[model samples]
Target: MKRLILVVYLLITLGCDKKYLEAKPDRNLLVPVHLEDFQAILDNTADMNNSTYLNFVGADDYLTTNSGYQSASYLMQNAYLWKADIYQNSQTGDPVGDWSSCYKQVFNANVVLDGIDKLGGTADAKLAGVKGTALFFRAMAYFNLAQLFCKAYTTQGAANDAGIPIRLTADVNPRPARGTLTDTYRQIISDLESSLVIIAGNSNFKSRPSKLAVRALLARVYLAMGNYEQALFYAEAVLAESNSLLDYNTINATLARPFPAALPNGNAEVLFYSAMPSLAFLTSQQNSIHPEIYNAYSENDLRKQVFFIDRGNGIINFKGHYTGNVLLFAGLAIDEIYLTKSECLERLGRGAEAIACLNQLLIKRMKTGTYVAQVSTGSNLQLILTERRKELLYRNLRWMDLKRLNLEEATALVLTRTVNGVSYKLVPNSGLWVLPIPDNELIAGAVEQNIR
Candidate 1:
């Protein structure tokens, strides 16, 4: 029997009421009957895993080469230039795969959670772990979708702003309208909180969800939500579990690819392992690191040597991805947790503790004994944020950071891109920050598109 591929939207009868949408997985053929079967669905990295290629292109991390720019797909080119219409038309199909892929994960996760209760002889340990994992995956998918599809979560207008559709069941009922931003976050946080208690035990595999990974993800989500205290709490909780940083001094940075790729554990710093598809790897031959970002790295910083490959002629490619593959690491790592904790601490007025955290991470990133502890002062928030940007470059984060930072009166960022002698600028709080929902989805689901 063929596998049942669950989907977010269902095609309804024409002229039928829009509220009564319905879709069903293949009922007789591929329903998961056992623990292992559900686990297999969760383990399908190709479908269940998330990718950040479109977000990476939209972000300000790397610039495409002239040939790379011309050779890219229509969606890639448009996203690279931040055009209002990335999908072109309904006939063009989905502009990016992340949207569908993430929702598929959520569907599969719901399937697993629903089926687990029906299975007989499922041990207590198996039940707890599997249920916790399903919840974690669902929360993660929702969080990723919210970041891309919805506007930034502002305390003021979040109750009114449209969020991605929230699906908690595997049933055929599919009248899934976009909920308010506040409702979306409430669901995400609720899932994470529930999963945190269930996955309290540790897992040996970084790819698997565990208590620590939940904490890391919560830290990331809260940070995005601009809740500094909660972000710091979760970040430090993850740090408390394991706060190891890779010592760049120990690695041979001159190798063709400096980082080890095939390690079973992936990069030691990674708290949870998730990555963008390898197809989007930014090679020096293809994409160049923005000059300003690259120049900000001091000579003493080992990341300049280990994390980047100098392609002579002013072109540089990022090499320091935790996955050690072209797949940009879109997962949680200790370095990010430390940075998050540091930033939250600084923002919350624990400046000295924040500097200490930065110093700890920088000591490992910099050349042996060349690191200097930075001061914990008001002016240094920008410095801290700059370091955060540098540390997490090409990890599919800058777009959301730009959104939250733009909300601040002090750090409102106006971004500009110059392509082929034409200049494109994105003003702070521009609606372009929220990308359009793919046309086919908007039509099929009877949903409204984001305002340009």
Candidate 2:
């Protein structure tokens, strides 16, 4: 089956009797909004798994095979950052699939949100928890789509800088306009806060929505808003709850094997991972492990084994520590939670605490005793950012991460390994960074058109 995307609208069907308002919830109009459904949607919608959307939006997995190889979608995306050659067929008309798919996930969340209202007194703490999670996830989905479908998050973006389509209601036909980036983020923050009320008071789905997901989402949102202290506050919430880290030894013992056939979800470092799709040979797809990633890994570095493979063909060899179908690793992991905390803390001038969090995670991954505080102090922020990257590389964190940092910094750092053998540079916050509005949506007037 395709990704778990169901857009249902539970519009009130008017009737003569009061019993009509109390009609049993229809699965067609509403899906199960418990923890199970929340996790299911999250697991299914991961960027790594199969999505005609969501692929090759610059997480640095785009490695070329031989000289003549072509990956159009990825190439066009990379053109805004890193290395991708602009060829004739490189453009994919409109980027409706990405816009549609992300919104589809949001639509699913909205269905749950609406169902919560209809469920009314039938709702328990578990339902409340699910509602919060759905809100957070919907906010997250909109946040990502907005960043991907619109221009950079600049003060200038406050205008109708052409952000992603805003789908607030579960109604599939909710014809909304392209909200401003600021407006979109405001809505995302609103959803997250509302979600926090539901997620925080519940204990049933402790490991699912729990309070951690809300805090994590809060941290992410605050970071996006440039509010470091608030971000730090929430990220610390997650770090306090779990000491989750990607233990290298555990990965070696459990997850390290061959490519997809090996350990599906590589180390304990994995914070949140979706189901591994049953697609054949994952690493060799359009966005494969860049040869630079393989080359950069030290022979002694344990992570090198899980991420790279030495195929003698000299083409591009890969190893996906997490291959096949996805399993939910997104919300409940210690790695990302800690990383989020570390970044937030560092940005908030809590250098020692940030470094401590960073070291805690690094020591676990590297199996080292500890890191020196003095040495890890001056560049604590950079260290935190880089660790987040190293930990979450190719895990679909790059696009937003780049957007968060200085655009020129991104242009300087992104190194495209190959593109028709002629290396190209990314344009940081260029218009190309945002996906072209999907072709179908543009031509048929299905969705608002984005500039090419």
Candidate 3:
């Protein structure tokens, strides 16, 4: 069954238009027939679990030298500058870029769902798990895509704003039109809520989705949508089930990679394991941590040493990926949940509770004895946000944070980047925050291109 699916997948990969709007798998191709076959489709982590790296390139977490900027790929270069068109003159049918990659996951999930629907019977626990997994993956893909391709969701604008194509079935011939942002988020939340009722508990493997992962993802989605009460509810749900933070003091900060691999034996705080596709600029020595962010960590904070490598001559590179390797980890973890809970609490005016939640994770990240717990002063919100920026660095999250934070007056940012001798700035609420759809997708006539 696995071999059969692989053959069909390769054939689809080679022959179809990779754009989600126009992907056209051959009608004669074989489809998965059994339950295990569907499970195998979802378990293909390389296709199902990898996430977009463009957000990281565009984020403010890191900067590159002039030489390094020139050395980056054309995609990375334009993304860094926040250009109106990032894929200028790039070929239409490239199968390896972020658009196709995310849609591939969407296609795979739809395939599993179609197969599960055909295998109608009194579903056993295994079948139930498989169905829930499919729903979770589909929701996750849409959420990630929405963050990058759609405008930041606001109650007033979501009803009219354009969103990515919502593909709900395996049949790729149908080019679904770009729906409203409201419908897109509605589908994501509905799928997750359905999965929450179906999935039982945490899976043994972090790569697979479970009830806990569903809750955590829900928390993340609500946080992005600016629904603080719902975000707090879901975050507290995840914390109540499992809230373990890795002790940074125990890590060997001298090693090139401080964290262990996130499989077999990896970080305990991880709820789901997914990573960004590797890119040379992210791992290059020339790609140094932003000075302002790097200097924000206190001397006693173990993360200062545990997460970065001072390559001498004022070059500081990030080595503390939760993936335990070069690939940047972008999946759910307990630390993020704690931060979300704290932020939501602070927004709800529960300042003391928010400070406690922030301290709970901070203590684990600091040196065992040198740490001092933070109090609920007037600045607890800023303090929590500062820690969030530090702890969740390079997790493919900073871009989303920037988008959501910019909506508020106090937290809005005006980002500036100087390349060569020229300067580029991205103002808050600029349409540039919503990236343009690929030219191929526009040419396919399925969706309207974003105005930037």
Number of the top candidate by lDDT?
Answer: 3
lDDT of each: 0.78, 0.54, 0.86
Worst 10 residues of 2 by lDDT: 7-16
Which is the winner by lDDT between candidate 1 and candidate 3? 3
What's the lDDT for residue 134 in model 1? 87
Q: Please, what is the TM-score per model?
A: 0.92, 0.73, 0.95
Per-residue lDDT of 1-452 in model 1, one digit per residue for the tens?
13423321221121122334433335454456767777777766665555556777788887776778877777778888889988786444433477767767777788788888777423577877888888899999998888788888888988999998788876535648887999999999999998887764776676777898899999999999999999999998988879888889998898766666523575678777788875633443678888889999999998899888877877788887777766778887888999999899989988888888999988898888788878777656887899999999978888889889989989887777777778888888888888888776776675778998
What TM-score would candidate 1 get against the native? Answer: 0.92
Q: Is candidate 1 or candidate 3 better by TM-score?
A: 3
Q: Taking the tens digit of each residue's C-alpha lDDT, what string does model 3 give over 1-452?
A: 65666655764564355444354445446656788878888888887889888888888998888898999888889999999988877445454377878888888888778878778722777777888998999999999899889989899999999988998987766778999999999999999998898875868788898899999999999999999999999999999989988888889999999998886447798899999987787788998899999999999899999999988877899999989888999999999999999999999999999999999999998888887888898557788899999999989999999999999999999988889989999999898888888877776657898899
Rank candidates, lDDT, best first. 3, 1, 2
Backbone collision tally, model 3: 0
After superposing candidate 1, which stretches have Cα over 4 Å from the reference? 1-26, 91-95, 120-123, 280-284
Model 3 CA deviation exceeding 4 Å by range: 18-29
lDDT of 1 at 4: 29
- Residues 60-119, model 2: lDDT tens digits: 554545422443444443442333232223234433445555666676677667667777
User: CA shift at 59, candidate 1, in angstroms?
Assistant: 1.0
